[model samples]
Target: MTKRAGSAGRPTKPLLKAPVRIGSVDARAVVGELRQLHEDAEDPDVERMPADDELFGALLYVEKHAHALRRQTPEVQRAAALRRVQLWEYVREQVDVHQMHAVDDARQAGAQWIELAPVLAVNAPSAAYNKAKRLKAVELTDETPQARPLRRTPEAVLRAERRIASERAAERQAQEVAQLRHELLVPVVERLLEQRESFESDEDIDYWWEEIEAVLPHCQTPLQMVSLRRYLDAVLRALAKIEKRTARPVALSEEALLALAAARKVRQLDASR
Candidate 1:
């Protein structure tokens, strides 16, 4: 094309501007389409699964949690939860590890199980029911401390009530840790702890005992610090204690969950009164 002379006497043609459009191919669509063409379809993938040893370690964690929760308190239970929160926060921010991996099974493997809440437990409805009953057992109506004429004295009753309250707190803390342990460890424990026997061996008992030992130091709740050695001696009784003798899993039944919730509500009311 020939240039045209401008009014200012400079040889010029109106610069034919490139069609100012925004698309993969200068189409009449939207601005975002061009960026979409360059964006990656998927992120770089790598091995996320824990190694064999790491998997076993995860199972150990599950076992530990289950053992602890059958008898802990709310405050202690809450601390266990904080541990999980810390792991994820640090991992996402790519932070270092110090008090890492509540179990630390995979410390050498260097494999991180980046899952959030992947463990599951199979406990009877009764376990939770028992937990609720212990926690929310307080009362306030006509059963005033001094008014109720019991074989036990007013001082004894007060002392008993205080003791029971402490015991209940321990129970709650245990329950919370139990929940955490089961969720993280159930699958792996099921996989690794597959010794086909009705009764656990003395070694098995020892392992279970060790788990209790590890978390008991962290057990600050009332009654939680008490040794379970006696129960462990009565192997069958210890099995019965957890309702772990059975393989079947039952959610807290409607009646059971309600009972626990009822106890909780009553306790809440009593505390206010």
Candidate 2:
């Protein structure tokens, strides 16, 4: 009889073995082993099974074992879930202990809650504060006794009233001074405009404006300064129109003329100083 293929010359390859049934095995232990195997497979130095048949066999083994665990009785599943809860609670308690230590150490180092907030990984300083408060991890100090209120004499009260009245009178006097300054400057600006209607060149006009600008800081109020600036802007626009040879002169409002006068007076005051 002819020898079976390859048996006579070379030993035949061994047949693939059936996966072992995982019946009645400790499901948690099996899962833990599977997890370890997965971690080992993920190692860069470890060589994985290259053949498709070998890979498939490994996959089927894990699938059948996992399916068996999933199909276990309801009581077994409940016990597994309870074990997981217990494990998680233990982890949480350890984390709480660590956090409490961290907070206490920070407090001992004289660090404020706001300063410690960023390092605690909380949403905000206030949240960190609340957490520290809940843990009773913050240090406290003794409160000072409250002092009794003092009673003022009638003469003292009268003196305070007089001081307040004086302050009001001073404010009104300052306002009047500012108003008088504004009124005096307006006419000076109008007179300057009447003197210089047109310029020979843009350079001359620019120089003229610069001279006026040098005195602007002498103006008492911001309103006077702002009005002066508006007047200058109008003057520049009018010059631009004149440069274009436009027949119409840029119109000026009564308020703008007053502003021009005020700016000119500010210039004179600045020169005198």
Candidate 3:
């Protein structure tokens, strides 16, 4: 049975001497500083405490040396514990956000709620869906450590659903834009590659050719899709400069011309918006 949602109380505050805002400082720097202070208290002469470059290793060292830390003064121990608690809280909040995103992705990939039930440790599909919704609601809440958490009310859940849907729609549109741009660029790049040997000896074409070559691998993957259009424009500009002195005009395939038109229309639409 689903338990009734309770009213959210004042959010838990870390046992910090001065309330340090979470995320305002880099985690490595904060943890490293705390580790230094604690280490100094434990053994001031230890030469091998984790340096700035070895923050992760230092964190692991502290984990392994927890027992030794117990002998340190109460003040030192309390400060360490406070930072740990705050960091863990932030980590848990991010975990919930990731979990919700994962569930959304699974659903998009055609995984039924019944299939997710087992993975979510829930007995039924509805429970799994509700749990995901709750997590989404939590993500929509203020991230400040002391902010009161959003209650799992019907209204809050509805808001979460709407926000998630809007975001997913935006993501789909961006992906579509990328795919369209890729289609526009591939043919142009193929033409460039065909003419590469001819351009190799031309000192004037060398700079732009090298630039295009540097970004070539990235164009083949969606990893840099957002910048792909810019790269294509640069390549086109370079091609224009190269075309000026060549006896033959650079020509594009009929399909490539159509794609270029479509891509420009998309760009115009985006600019108008």
Candidate 2, RMSD to the unseen true structure: 29.8
Model 1: residues with Cα > 4 Å off, grouped in runs: 1-152, 187-273
After TM-score superposition, what is the CA distance of residue 226 in candidate 2 from its true location, in Å? 5.1
Task: Work out the TM-score per prediction.
Answer: 0.16, 0.25, 0.43
2 or 3, which is superior by TM-score?
3
lDDT of 1 at 1: 79
Q: How do the residues 54-120 of candidate 3 rate in per-residue lDDT, one tens digit apiece?
A: 5455555665565666777787777777766666665666667789899999999999999999999
Error of 3 at 50 (Å): 9.0
In model 2, the worst 10-residue window by lDDT is 14-23
Against the true structure, whose lDDT is highest?
3
Give lDDT tens digits, candidate 2, residues 1-273.
976785564332221222122223343444454444434435332234222234333334444443344555566545545544443444444455567688879889998878878877777878777665544311111122432111122333344446557878999997776576556655565555554533423554666565455545465566655566455555555465664785543225554445444554575564364
Task: Enumerate clash totals for all models, in the order shown.
Answer: 11, 4, 0
Alpha carbon lDDT of each predicted model? 0.35, 0.50, 0.62
**Candidate 1 local lDDT, residue 246:** 58
Q: Indicate the worst ten consecutive residues by lDDT in candidate 3.
A: 12-21
lDDT of 1 by residue, 1-273 (tens): 766666364332232222121112211121122112212211112122123234333333433443344344565445445443443343332211222232143325653233211321215444433322222222211135643322212343355567667878999987876555434333322222232133334565556646555544454443442333222233333433445645532213454334323333433443353
How far does residue 198 in candidate 2 sit from its true spot (Å)?
A: 4.5
Candidate 2 residue-pair clash tally: 4
